[model samples]
Target: MSLEAYIWCAALKLDVCNGTPFRVLLCLADRADSLGYGAYPHVSTMAEQLGCSDRTVQRAIRDLTAAGLIREGDQRYVQHLDSRYRPTVYDVLTTALVTLESRGDNRVTPNRSRGDKKRHPGVTSAVALRTVQEPTYQDSSRELTLVTAQEVEEDQ
Candidate 1:
């Protein structure tokens, strides 16, 4: 587990994530390898670590999976003389962190317009102002360019 990865996970927006799911995500991030592969831990163990019920942990796993932040990986089944069990491996999608970092300046803000029927009532939206400037790179030597969501949509 990289300290930088854990820090990145901790800095995610809480408005879009419930407490349990966010804690579960942090736990997985703590065990992730350089490639974002996390070792499978028993549900009971995870529950203990997160200080929650096993059912809560299960729900968190479901939420993370549904949100596309984590994906099920390989499974290992252990067969004993009288019992069998399979442990689920997970791959945390680190690309989500990159996307989030790139959109750090863009956050959900309340839309006070009365005629904005395209948006739900009392709901907030993240709308980045369009710009025609060239993409900015954090590292000039690496040639890594940050593209906004609107830019990707425009390209498509």
Candidate 2:
């Protein structure tokens, strides 16, 4: 279970009068990974966990999909003895969070536009830059010598 996904799901402000869709979303988020993927529980499993019928769980899933909260993922086939059922996976879309943040009510407005005014003036200077000095050693005496860029260019 991914705590991050669950927290994000809990933070979502759904506009539903009934709580079934929100509960189902929380269940999916509980099974999702850190990236909000890999929630593939069976419909019956979710129904049992939520104390609701399979049809109710299915409807909740449909509602979430319609609301752009969760999306259906790839189906996995079972290869058990005489069993050939494909289970549907679900992925909690983080895009929903971005959409929520971009909404008119939730959007953050800047205090002022960039074209209004400048708080600080730009800095400009007309100073001449100097070349770095390099040190050289000769023999074991370890004498320190400083060489400037002009001297090195002249030698070259």
Candidate 3:
């Protein structure tokens, strides 16, 4: 779906709450689209539409970047809008995630079992916690603690 449409649908379906900015963004972005513009908004423009200050827009941009929903690049990124890129960002991201998960590295994938594991050499069980301790309760009140190599060094 178009970014603007996606945002609008999400905002409307979610009913503001945390979606107000995205709703505003979608509205402004749609307006920009109608103007025959591929305008990558400066924070001020975004803020004006969202009825927020520039800082708020900036924060949203930063959050989007951190979440990998948006990215920055030199002129090349703009020239090849990710929306137009073959093997779009979403495809590449999901493929990469799948690759890692098949190798038993991603924490978010399920359907992993011994048969699946045998397919990949050197893959460890995802459920296996590489912890150093076996829990031993000191008293009725159980307090969990991770044993570390440091304690051995201190003893020596």
Candidate 4:
């Protein structure tokens, strides 16, 4: 998986807060080249990796396409004696394309639209939380206190 692509997708708020779409996007992004285009895999493969149904993968693809995060490219077709199957090709929208289309300003800057501000105003970065201690009963009451690395550092 491309950590940079995942981070870019998350930071840019390109997806609706759904894990499936993000996961599908990540799969495509992982295979994408520098131009943000990649060979499309079968829906069954994506569903297997994401642990979702084929319909769910299709829905996520539709959503991403509608959101302009990805564009359908040339399709590959295999012709058999009695039948032919065509697989879709997906092209992830580059940062430049995303900025140009979504931002409404042809500038290659971060999108800070009102919707983004409303959804993630206070989120500056993602920090992983490690449990220092498990919850326990004290004085016949149960209380859970979660501490993060930032908190530990601050305490020190």
Task: lDDT for model 2, please.
Answer: 0.71
Candidate 1 to truth, TM: 0.52
Per-residue CA lDDT of candidate 1, range 1-156, in tens?
756556767777877666899988888778765445544667788899988899999999999999887888544222222234455777666764446647874323222245556544545443333344556776468665899999999999
Cα lDDT tens digits, model 4, 28-135, are 877655446543667889899989899999999998888778898534322212234455778778684465557675322223244554434645333223335556
Q: CA lDDT of 130 in candidate 3?
A: 53
Alpha carbon lDDT at 80, candidate 2: 27
Top candidate on TM-score is 2
RMSD of each: 18.8, 19.2, 17.7, 17.2
Q: Considering TM-score, which of the candidate structures 2 and 4 is the better prediction for this target?
A: 2
> Candidate 3's residue-wise lDDT over 58-99, tens digit each?
666555445443344223224444554322111111223335
TM-scores vs. true structure, each candidate: 0.52, 0.54, 0.33, 0.50
Task: Please identify model 3 stretches exceeding 4 Å from their true place.
Answer: 1-17, 20-39, 73-156
lDDT of each: 0.68, 0.71, 0.43, 0.66
Candidate 1 vs candidate 3, lDDT winner? 1
Worst 10 residues of 3 by lDDT: 86-95
By TM-score, the candidates rank as 2, 1, 4, 3
Compared with the true structure, what per-residue lDDT tens digits does model 2 show for residues 20-110? 9999888888987765666877788889999999999999999899988888753332222234444577878765444554674342222
Who wins the lDDT comparison?
Answer: 2
